[model samples]
Target chain A: MSDTQTTVEPVRMGRKATQPLLIVNDLVKTFGNGVKAVDGVSFTISPGETVGLVGESGCGKSTTAKLLLRTLDPDSGEVKFGGQDLLGMRGRALRRLRSRFQIVPQNPQTSLNPRLPVRSSIEFNLRAHGVPKPERVERIAEVLEQVGLPGAYGDRFPHELSGGQLQRAAIARAISTRPELVICDEAVSALDKSIQAQILNLLAEFQKELGMAYLFISHDLSVVEHISDQVLVMYLGRIVEDGTGSQLWNRPGHPYTEALLSAAPGAERERIVLVGDPPSPANPPSGCTFHTRCPIAIEACSTKRPLLKPTAGGSHAACIRTTDLQQP
Target chain B: MTVEAQAELVIDAAGETSDAVLSVRDLTTTFTAGGQRIEALRGIDLDLYPGRVSVLLGESGSGKSVTARSILRLYGASAIIGGSAVFEGRDLVGLNEKEMQPIRGSGIALVPQDPTGSLDPVRRVGAQIVEVLRLHGVVDSKKEAQARAEELLGLVGLPDPVRAARSFPHEMSGGMKQRVAIAIAICCNPTLLIADEPTTALDVTVQAQILDLFVELTSSIGSAMLMITHDVGVAKDLADHVSVMYAGRIVEQGATSTVLDDPVHPYTKALLAAVPTPDVPRGNLIPIIGQPPVSGMTLPGCSFAPRCPVAQSSCTELVPELVSVELGHSVACPVATEFGAA
Candidate 1:
């Protein structure tokens, strides 16, 4: 990046907490094999807050992450980041906007370039975003320090680092770009328990320091509840429930969310063993996609496409019996 | 039998002398890699009783899987096995391939972590189970083996056993594949069944179902289970006896409720505290301060001393051994042991 190039800033920074950092509405995507991976998913994320998107495998959380990053284009709907129409942006504009949000991938082994030293991966992001050469050097050292890695570790290759260290390096690379939002798709799920806590703490620390929002995605419900302020449960390509972590933990409105809570190992609640395998996303069940496995699902649930509605517990759920289900 | 072994068996008060289906004593395994011997298991001891689930709980490098594999003699030429693993009054440690053949499936069976890796991808799920049944001589004919295969699938809670038996490994979901794996493992009615993180790859709801199946099948068949997992919740859910491993040694072992609720070893306490559970509030997880020692690295003292909160000056010099804290509960921490004694 050269001085005096005078490139336009893609995103205006420093928004109030009331305004959303990322707004996704009715996003839809279907794969080549006709799998409706993401089906009309909609959510909003405020700056400096963490929103957990959780579900079992094949529930479209990864597809949603890809669509939000524009790595995979959604077949329909809008993704507005920092008041700009992200999906409508052209080549240079889209590339310029890329630095505004970044990803901390699940597995750092594949995400980080194995051949290059850790410094180069972080430096690559800076250079691509047009950070000056001198600034790039400083940012690399700074981010590495912020993530609790020693300055000397920048010289080491990916394989030299442990799983936890690689994840920290992944976080350093993501934050080196100074992105307003970081999407952590199963970031800590791959790590061991003791190491997982360290990474989670680092994320919380960085979020407070940088004031960046996070779209934390994981199959582990407890980890999601621990890190996220707001929680969204997805089943068969749809958001079954959305609420604050406390609301969903105490009084889950959707049967899928309730079943998920019960199924968690060591969860003291009565086990609701959902029989049969999850149906293929390509051939999802009609109306309520979870009706096939929901323990409390009524016959009407299969016929009616229940919209996201507010429950008595102040959380929004997409179940007809959301109000009456949580009576004890 | 050795005179010392006979004396120890009679004096052992933790469990009934005749109850154990498998008794592992001072089991150690070492592998020669790059001309360096990696001591994966270091003087481990365990007693697996019939109709009970004993969980070996630890992280990846803690040698939980190695313990299970060593019992079954899964390692080839690279591994140097030490100590004894007695199953049904027979020592399994020194047995050759031919001698161990009959014991492998009929005496003991394993349900590995990944069903996809364990199951034959090309063969139908039923054919695989039938092969195990016929190979073990559990059933007389192919016709009887086929019927037993479908019956075993249904026992593991596969809703449609007939259809599941016809499908290939790729055709079934992770949960269903795991069920098939469980079905094959329990088909022989082995006295000892080892499940290595059986539900780790499946969804939570599916994990619950599989856990339920483990309890039901183990009790009904009157087989002892040695379940290996890193998840504390999984151990809490299924384990009747819990053994916590750290840096290739058993740090704690006791009844599940006693060990999990009143953890004596600092490592066990820290591990249980660190895990994010439904009851623990957000951001309250107290992470263990340091990394676990590199696997196979010889330690002079307790492996956990570097990270132990209540480490004493002597802890750096003294290697802790499992000392009884209560009936059926033992902790390998000198500091904790002293406290319990006091």
Candidate 2:
């Protein structure tokens, strides 16, 4: 199928026509031991748009997600949500804005309380936001049905439910409060192929129906390509490449992005195997963090860091040889 | 590199009929949990041909891992195992623990899924491999075992084998630990190797490299491989033969190309369609409705009937045997049998 044919037109929610819903600039987060988990990242998520964050392990994808949610404080950054300063919000302000942002974690089995029934789990969040008991009950059933789970499933414990069912319940809870933007961190990675498809379809359906945005973080490229409007490729805690899904998939300018795309199965492309492992984030290489593993690395790559610049394919790539690289 | 070369390799090692180094027939395993008998494996039959890769593909709780554990006799004492696993004219199922001692490692090696859990955290990587080599009598002296351990590490594509051997399990990455596990598995050069989801914990790039390493190592050692995984892409990339298992039974088995390209079984077809390929558009995923039958639950006929889209009344009434519709291709669904023949 063609990329354009598969693309789902974003349904505009009840927001200002032109203003972006969320805007982040120069976000930086460093750990206790001097590990730059998220370093100098910036992106914008418009209403109802799915922005995919792709990277391997230790590339700060999860850290970036946490930073965006304010679960981890950023060293320096400006986060504006709905024309309001999100990073500057505190106390009652942050709690009130909590309902507008929700996160769906990777493993639903661990995320849900084993002792609590699915109903109570969904109700807990709504009750925390001061929703009435009757409204919470009505919303619980509606959200459960929306996630393709039966109403009776609310009475069942997490251990009694299947992996797929438990994940559906978790999604139900995330959307129970009607969050405008949901952060899915490796949400469908733990599921089987069949169940993964079901979950992906559910996510897309909810996005269209509710007119919500998603910051989908996953290492799986195919899933990202299917769901994302814009894609960001991170390497060693830095955004190395950024473009629309079709633009990035069809023409990857960065060497790291090229290798990652080639490694994914079912793509009819030549495999470009890198020579060595990724360098540790704690001791990343000087010039280009990816210079140690880049297939087309030169002497300059080890000395001078390349900044993200506009490439030929209407994408931004942090590679000095972006112009010299062949189109994928 | 070519089809001709693969064909030549297949013929050079063993002729078609005598290619099976290990043949499992009517293999059944039962476990008692909370005083309830669970039929984990229900009369499974499989063949592992020498120098060829055979994949057992299934979803979780589909008995793919149980089949691997049963072949190695890794179940507890309460578990009852019934069947014959014949390897080189010997029935492994009939052999006791004392009798199966030598066959465990030297005859058949295992590459487990979780590398961190499988390796010794306290011991250096090289010492663990050396222990396996010396225990299997693959080498004579300690010095020789150490040399062989580093050599095996190098063979598995570890860039600095010496450094990797000196490092502990905690010091290495997931992919690095897996490479070390592969080195330990092939240290003895057994006739058969069982890798259970060896690359599931790794990244795509690492997984591809490990898959290549498996093919290379197995081919060089002329060892038959029985790999278990839930990913169809891994099977398509690695398997010479593919067997689709569901609810503890082999629903379909055939040559990898034939089965993947033209699947006859409904379950296999659904599985292939469910994977989110790069070419497939969003919202077009054909997800299989409902989940697999829970463990210990007895179904009258086809276990997949409740979820099968085209299941007939007869499918719920009678269990179908694995009948062949074409040469080397078998299916356990009556409706698929009729449709495939047509």
> What residue pairs are clashing in model 2?
none
The lDDT per prediction is: 0.88, 0.86
Give the deviation of candidate 2 from the true structure as CA RMSD.
Answer: 4.1
State the fnat of candidate 2 relative to the true structure: 0.51
> Per-residue alpha-carbon lDDT of model 1 for A1-328, expressed as tens digits?
0001212112222555465778888899999999999998988887887889999999999999999888999999899998999999978899899998999999999999999999999999899999999999999999999999999999999999989999999999999999999999999999999999999989988877788889999999999999888899999898988887888888888888888998999988887788777889999999899888877788898998888887777678889978767544
Query: Cα miss at A205, model 1 (Å)?
Result: 0.7
Error of 2 at A150 (Å): 1.5
State which candidate has the highest TM-score.
1
lDDT score, residue B180, model 1? Answer: 93
Name the DockQ score for candidate 1: 0.61
Native contacts retained per candidate? Answer: 0.72, 0.51
Docking class of 2: medium
How do the residues B30-132 of candidate 2 rate in per-residue lDDT, one tens digit apiece?
9999999999989887878778999999999999999988888888586799987877767888888887878888888899999999999999999999999
TM value for model 1: 0.95
How much does each candidate deviate from the true structure in C-alpha RMSD? 5.4, 4.1
Error of 1 at A8 (Å): 30
